[model samples]
Target: MEKYTPLRTATLKPKSIYYPLHIRKLIKHKKKLFKEFKNSNFGLDEYIKVSKTIKHLINSYKSQKIKSIVSNTNRIYKYMKNISQKYSPIPCLENDNIFIFDDKTKCNLFASVFARSFSNLPTFDPPELTPCKFMHALDDIEFNLLDIDNILKNLPNNNCCAEDGISYTLLKACHSSITPFLSDIFRLSLDTGIIPQSRKVSYITPVFKKGDKNNAENYRPISITSTICRVLERIILNSLLIHLEENNIISQNQFGFLKKRSTTTQLIFTFSHWYKAVLESKNIDCAYIDLKHAFDSVPVRFLLYKLFNIGIRGKLLNWISSFLTDRTAKVKINNTFSNSFQIHSGVPKDPYWDPSYF
Candidate 1:
């Protein structure tokens, strides 16, 4: 009997091996043709035909893995939906009072209060203090007072005027300005003609010096942005409450007072307490309407009306209008200055001195 060798070791293999050999020969023949065509001056039409054939062959050989994945995914989703229907959660009709919700999950409007009570909060760095630090400190202390004076000075003859104390006067002026607007919305006498007392009844005198590290007692304190934020928040909340009461959403009995605190922590804690009280008492449907560009998009006519309702008149209104008309923003480093265009919408992260101006 003749010894038989494996097909791989045989000089001449079976048709199965010859099949692959034939395929390789065909591939080599095509490559040779392509090389010849490249070497010769083939017309654009011939070149295109060859390219299309190559692309077609390559595409035909490519795996359909993506298609398979997509099909599997569709099947999985269908199965999941069936399972979900069998174990679906009960629909909740009563909304959560603590969190405001819109068409999407997020609320459209919310108020923030600014107050920094603790002396240990980080101080403004050297660059920030390089400007008139003394003036800045003084200005911060006198913000509410200054705003009241301005409102009084701009009061229209038709509107009520502030009488004596800064807070008292501003409250009166604010009520006069805001009442008509509220009345228009509610078709009632929404104007209280009184300002709510400042939640912050006292101010902690700010420490000025950049204290030395060695003198542990003398180190400067952190500038509390929270304090100012809280103040603005209180103003917003009070205004809203007054409007709501006028609209009959709440009654005088439902109304409550919140004492103002000088420190950031106190302000936050008090606000949290007030928040809990409101949540417990009422079925509040809070809506936070965030306009695309609040400051920039504020139409001149509409803003004027709002200002007028707040008792702003004549030159002050004109001044505000003019100030907003041609807006320009810039940042300076060392001595060089570069100007930039200001956006019309979106809330700024850090609270500026007059955020309304933005």
Candidate 2:
């Protein structure tokens, strides 16, 4: 019996910055008064007075903290996250008339729903196009130690780690020791069209979208891949953009991923055209089209075909093909994780990869 040890458990309680020691002591005293009131009906009035005083102090402290945080631009988001750290466990999920209460089962249900959201219809063959004449072929791009170090330095320090359990903080801290090795690996991957298997596996968390929380379809999967994988992606993206810009492969009208162009610029350009049409006394006709799951539903084969037509061929294209294929992920709900499953289609929902693919 002495050799057996009990499993220790701890509840997560985020400390509030605005909470004062005096108020906490007062609340403890209030609990003591409440106990006396319940036993002998002696301290009811004192308990009420203490409760009101604690409430007033809390409001005052919260207001002061908000004012200080608002005065500084950098701390607003951090403060918001701290106050909004309340955890609400997901309720039981219903799938096919069966209710699932187990966390692992719930995670599996979400995985199945998210898997079906990918566009898995037959691939459409692209029409034949005239071969692009390039000044030079973009067969491969090499990375140096400086490039790796610079990318690591620019990475966000607050990002969560992926399934690989490698965090940005860890990479940035030990980059001097690992950059040379990473550079060699990147060069080899580009040259041989062989990417690491760990790079292709993502960790998914389901975030609530809208409607019934009990329904599995009401959540969207946010996929997180390895930190090292993203670094390689950045290197490839930079080279790809340079080739596209040099060859005039991408049109100016396509304003999503290019430099100095965004949704705001596109809106401004459209409104300017509308104002000119109004001045000319011309009739205006417009149609708005919004594609659902635009990022997740794109066929990988079709995307590869488009890239090939745009002069992204040879070893570079093969490397991209290898990166996109044979992807897998495990869905996590609370502390439970579902078994690993293969992802059939769609580019990763990461900020760096999604826009470039589009």
Candidate 3:
């Protein structure tokens, strides 16, 4: 058998498991007291009063300690110098919409860097759904079939059935027609403005000085949470347009107009109206899925397909792919050593500009 020897100077300490013996004993005593109190013929009012008193005492002690700590560290002068130095230079713009930073002729140099980074993301793609396959799935779930005749009848009076019909020809030729079914669903929502009420409030406007540019330093920066919500609104509108266009539900010209019309403000107002109706109905079992890190993990192939579907053709696609190659950045611990770092870059989150391009 091998002999075990302890080290003269210990390099590693054994992990210690601590048992809260005192706390356990106190808890046991409290349980015994509670049992005794329950067994006794003590008045309910007295028991309630005693419980309230104990809670109040504990809370008062905690509040006193917290206040003391807060008072000791609340020196305003120490933070003044730091705050004064942290002020950002005010931004100004010149004629021709060019930004001039710090009175220099150069535009905000960081803007270009940020734009290049944004443009280098993998092209976007919507998931494909064949009309027949979609219909079959819906049928399996017993979804209500939309009124196609009513939809066709509501088409603009000036719509040329012969010429405009070609837009939907590709969809008709497909082995499974998914776009028409999607179009029906879209039309139903458009007519009713069906907004799900469960979506959490993602943004709020920050209070800032009205038209007083000098007081910029006094206001908190615009909330990033609000910006993200606006982006989500844009993404939804863009997705709807993309779905319509891909399914041949609308002409390219019609798609362009719809894209321009769908705005974040409009969507929010529409959703607000929808939720009001939902509340009136008193139905409350709705749920919302908060997708974390949605953009970074978007498959490259899916993005390529979306681009292709939206008519991002030929050289544009190739150029975008090439741009993404060198645009990535790496985090390094040692500035000189390239190997001692991990590489990463910001992937395109659902952009606020999504509706405009779609």
lDDT of 3 by residue, 1-358 (tens): 1268554643543333232565345445555666767898555565565566555655665466456556544544433343344434444534345444442222223223223333433454455743221111100011122433233333232211111122222323331344356445444433343422221111111233346433322222121112212222332444444554565555433322354444555566657867997989855464547643333334445554555554444443443333223322211111111111111223222234322333
Model 2: per-residue Cα lDDT over 1-358, one tens digit each:
2369566677756675646789889989988999999999797888899999999998998888889889876699888887787766779998889999998999888888888867375645766777776667677787877988999888887447776678888889888899998898888888899977887888889988899999988988988888888899988888988998899877777878778898889989989999999999999999989987778877788788878877787899999999988988889876688888887778876686787887
- The 0-to-1 C-alpha lDDT of every candidate, in the order given, reads 0.34, 0.83, 0.36
Q: Estimate each model's TM-score.
A: 0.21, 0.78, 0.26
> CA lDDT of 182 in candidate 1?
33
Evaluated against the true structure, the overall lDDT of model 3 is: 0.36
Q: Which scores greater on lDDT, model 1 or model 3?
A: 3
Mind giving the per-residue lDDT tens digits that candidate 1 earns over 1-358? 1368444543532222122344455556667666777788555565566566655654543334334445686766754554354422112112334433231211111000011111112233322211111111100111244443344445333311111113433444575465444334222111221222231122111222344322212322222112222333333334433443444443223222322323555557657867987988954464546643233233444444444443444433443344333332222222222233232322222233233322
lDDT of 2 at 220: 85
TM-score of 1: 0.21
Output the better candidate (1/3) by TM-score.
3
